[model samples]
Target: MVKKYTVAIVASAMLLLTGCSQKSDVDASAQKGAESADSKLNQLGAGDGMMKLSDEEMKAQLIKDLEGKVESVYFAFDKYNITDESNSKISANSKLLGEGKAGELKIRIEGNCDEWGTDEYNYALGLKRAKASQDAMIASGTSADRISIVSYGESNPVCTEHNKECWAKNRRADFKLLP
Candidate 1:
C-alpha cells in the first residue's frame, strides 16, 4: 500500500512539473514569434528589407532587359527558306542562346503569314517559316530542344492596313522568350 501511494505521488509530481515546463515553453515560443513579426513589420514600415516587387515593376524590368535583344527573321512570299539577311539575324540570336546568359528560358518561334491565303494554307506556311528559322538556329549551334514553334496564319497581323508593306511585315517569324 505504501509503495502504491509513493508511485502515485511521484507520477502526479512529474505530471505537474511537465505541465509547468510546457506552458513556459509555449510562452517563450509566442514571445519569439511576436518579436519576429515585429521585426518584419519594422522592415516593411521602413520601405526596405527584401520586399516583393510590384507586377508593373517586374514587367518593366523584364522589358528593359529584353529590349532589342529578340530578333525577327522575315520570309519571302510563299517561301519557307531563310534568306541571307534572316540567316545573319539567326546567327546573332544563336550566339545569345548558346551563351546561356538568358538563363533557362525556352525560345518561342512565332510564324505568321500575309492575309492572302486560306486559313489552312496560311497556317501551313507559317509553320514552314517557323521551322526554317528553327532549323537555322539549330545549325548555328543552338540547342534544338530549347526552341518551340507556333504558327498563327492570316491572323495577328502586325499592320492592320491591307498593303504590300503590311503584308511583308506580317510574313515574318518572331522570337520570344518564355519562362
Candidate 2:
C-alpha cells in the first residue's frame, strides 16, 4: 500500500508541473506579441498608442500634408510682374521652405500665358512670369538653388472659354514640387 501511494503522488506532481510549464510558455508568447505591436505603433509616430497605422499609411499622410502647402501665384494680362496678393502668397511659400516644412524638395515654377499672343511671344511671356514668381520667392527667404523655371506658354489653359475671366485664369504661374 505504501508503494502504491508513493507512485500515485509522484504521478500527480509530474502532471501538475507539466501544466504550469505550458502556462508559462503561453504567457511568454503573449508578451512577445504585445512587444511587436508596440514596436509597430512607435514606428508610425504613435507614442500614446491609441491607434496604429502601417508604414505606407504614414507615408501617404505625410505626402498629402506636404502637397497642401504648395502655392500658385497668378499674373496680370501681358505682365510678368508680381501683384501684392501674389507677393504675399509667395512670401508664405518662402516661409514654409525656410522652416523645413517642405523638406529638401526642389520646386518648379511653371509660367503660363493667355491665348492672345503668338506661340513664340506667349512662350517668352510665360517664362518671364515663372521667373518673376521665382524671384519673389527668393526675395522672401527661399533658396534660389532649389528652384527651377518652366514655361508652358498658352498650351495648358485652366479655362477653355474665350472670355476675359478665363484668359485671366490662364495667365498664371503654377508651383510644382519636384522629386
Task: List clash counts for every candidate, in order.
Answer: 0, 0
Candidate 2 local accuracy as lDDT? 0.84
Q: What is the model-wide C-alpha lDDT for candidate 1? A: 0.84
How does residue 31 of candidate 2 score in lDDT? 84
* lDDT against the true structure, each candidate: 0.84, 0.84
Per-residue alpha-carbon lDDT of model 2 for 85-147, expressed as tens digits?
999999887787565436566778899998898669899999999999999998987889989
Q: What is candidate 2's CA lDDT for residue 144?
A: 91
Q: Give the number of the best model, judged by TM-score.
A: 1
| Candidate 1 residue-wise lDDT, 1-179, digit = tens | 99999999999999999999999999888886463546655655555636778766665566446636868988889998998999999999888755644535678899999989966989999999999999999999888898999999978689989899999999999888765
Q: Return the TM-score for each candidate structure.
A: 0.67, 0.64
